[model samples]
Structure formats: C-alpha cells, structure tokens
Target: MPSLSTALARALTVTAATVALAGVTALPGAPPAAAAPLPPGVVQLGDGEPCPPATLCLYRDYGFSGPAYGIGAGYAIDLRWLPMPGHGGPTAADNVSSWVNRTAGVALLIDEQGGRTRPLFPGQHLEEPVPLNDTVDRVVW
Candidate 1:
C-alpha cells in the first residue's frame, strides 16, 4: 500500500499537470483565482453589469437604466415604502425591472401577491425583467 505522503505527492502531481494543461500557473500553496473587482457604480452579475457594492439597487429598466432605488445593507425593506423616481409613477412595490445585490448575505424578494420568494446572493445581478416584477413586496436579508 502507498504511504500517505506518496498518495499526497501523486495528487499534487496530477493537480499541477491539470493546472498546466488548463493554462494556469500552479504555484506551491497558492490561493485560488480571486473574483474580479467590481466596476464603478456597477456590480457584475455573471457577465452582466453589477450594482454598487454593499447596496441593494433596484432599477426601473433593464440593463441598470432608468430610475434607481438604492438601499443600504442590513435592512429588511418593505418595497411599498419606496416610491417611483418621478411624479405620478407607481411605487417600487412590484415595479422593479432589474436588481443588483451587493450585500454580505443573500437577499430575498418576497412576492406581494403570492408570498413567493426569490434569493439573490451577494454580487448577484438580475439584468432581465423578472417574473416577480411588479410583484415584489419586500426585500429581506
């Protein structure tokens, strides 16, 4: 039977070879690749533009355009408390077209009509119109 040290050495060799084939340098005890830095005023979400870090940002239009509703971290916000940007517009409740979550913890969007919930992890961005658009009643951590 192979000793534990021998097994570990073999694993390291395999790992180094795999890393080299994948075009990444494998330094001894090196950390994994770090996440890319966020851009100014945007938090990247899976290749999409992101919201500002440590904020929960809601946009009136897709691609982070139009009116913006920004909330600080660590609060459970009732969407009804947020009004539209301009006069005569609807409340933020059920009116969020897109969102970016930059909080430390996962954020949830609770549906006002059906009590359904959607989870948004830290650094997640939703660029497309969500099914819960015009239906989100609350944002909770």
Candidate 2:
C-alpha cells in the first residue's frame, strides 16, 4: 500500500486537476454545453428590411437599419469588397454597425486577414452598436 503522504499527494493532484478543468470550462470563448435558442418573435426582418435566413447580415445602423449586407455560408468575404450604400461607393470596411448570424455555424469578424477574429454565434443577433463596428475588415464562416 502507498504511504499516507503518497496518498495525500495523489488526492491533492486530483483536486488540483479538477479545479483547473473547471476554470478552463468557465473561460470566455469556451464552447457552450448546448446551443441556445433564439429569443421569441425574433424574425429575420423588420419593417421590410431583409436579413435572409441562412446568411450572416451586417447593417450600417443600429437596430439593423440603414445599408445592409448579407454573406452566405462557405464564404470569407473581405469587407473591402463591399461598398457602402449611397456613400459614393466607399468600401464597407469599418462601417458595419449591427449584425445577425442566421447560419447554422458561427461567423467570425476579422480585424484583418488572418488577424484577430470575434465570433458571432449561430442564430445570434446584435441590434445595438458593436465596439467592433467599422473596425471589422473581414468575415468568415
């Protein structure tokens, strides 16, 4: 049989491992245990504005108004490729104010090609202005 000290050390190791795992699971950006459902009555469009199903949409105004852009699945669009609506055709870079993710997978807002990325969960919507607004240069599935 192991000595008393050996048994105590083993217990401590197990306890420490459990605590570490708990911390990791609680960390930000960890995958959720289950996907969350969208809130009730949250349609893809409002006031005839369009945010089509199975697409990731960006808006130039809060509350999903103003110029809208939609990206479909299996795409990695650079914001520079999108034009600002009615603004002399300026690139849409750093111009997105709100967004909705209607696709079945997460969407990522990238600051630069292969740079920092923020995840927009599937079926998620953000009506308010985002800090990453106008700073996003790329979107990827």
Candidate 3:
C-alpha cells in the first residue's frame, strides 16, 4: 500500500511527463499531427513579380504531406540609355554589363534573406541594402 503523498507525487510526475511529451510534439520542428495545408497566397518562383522591376522566386519541398514553402528570392532590373557620342560597339557591351552590375547590387539586398540569385559570371557578388549611387531616371514609358 502506498502513502497518499507518494501516490500524489507519482501521478503528478506522470502527468508532467505526458505534458512535456505533448509539448515537444507541438514544437515547430515536430511533424504536424495531420499534415497542414499550404497557406493561401503562397506561390511558385517566377509565377508573379514581387514588385515593379522586381522578381521573386521560391524553393519548395514536396515530399512532405503538406504543401511546401521556403524563403524566396527577389530581384529587380532597370534599363536606361547612357548617352554615347558616336561609339556603339564595345561600348554597348560595357553599358549592358554596367546596368547588370547595378541591378544585381539591388537584387542582392532583395534576395539577401534567402541567399539566392547569383551572377552567371565568377566575379559577381550580391550587395545588401541599396547602394548610395544607384540613382535611376524614370522612363516615360
């Protein structure tokens, strides 16, 4: 025969253990108890533009019973004409590269949270926050 005090303590310990186990199961890391459905407004990468001149891309994992979601990549591109007096051959390539560099810097900040969007070339890197000199001239179109 157990004392009342001992029985109470054992019951409390068992209850505590069960509650603790339940808590661990509810944690974000735990697999949800009945697969959750994807949230509304979730989208595939390139399905929609995040903002004007900006693009957003998403990475998904479909193996889970629930719809997949992950951090997305966003980018922006702006094109403008730089006045060149007469030259137009190599200068054209230089102008394109310059524009790409500027836009890439902005994209870096946009995609920094996900670490996506990289330059096709080896020497390029993403820039965070916006560059101080990235002034833009709006096109009439």
lDDT of 2 by residue, 1-141 (tens): 999999987976676667556743232333343322322322223332778888888887777787776778657787766656533236567777788888898888887733678899998997534445566787777
Expressed as tens digits, the lDDT of each residue in 1-141 for candidate 1 is: 999999998988888778877867565685654433332333223323446668888776667766666677767887666645433245567666788777888888888687788898888888645454566778887
lDDT of 2: 0.68
Candidate 3 lDDT, 1-141, residue by residue in tens: 999999987976676667556753243343344433333322232212222122222211111111111211332222122221112221111121122121222223112223333332222222222331122221111
Backbone clashes in model 3, listed as residue pairs: none
- Please give each candidate's TM-score: 0.58, 0.58, 0.20
lDDT of 1 at 125: 84
Query: TM-score of predicted model 1?
Result: 0.58
Error of 2 at 125 (Å): 0.7
Candidate 2 positional error at 117, Å? 0.9
Instruction: Estimate the overall C-alpha local distance difference test score of candidate 3.
Output: 0.27
In model 2, which regions exceed 4 Å deviation?
1-48, 85-89, 113-115, 127-130
Cα deviation of 120, candidate 1, in Å: 0.5
- Window of ten residues with lowest summed lDDT in model 1: 38-47
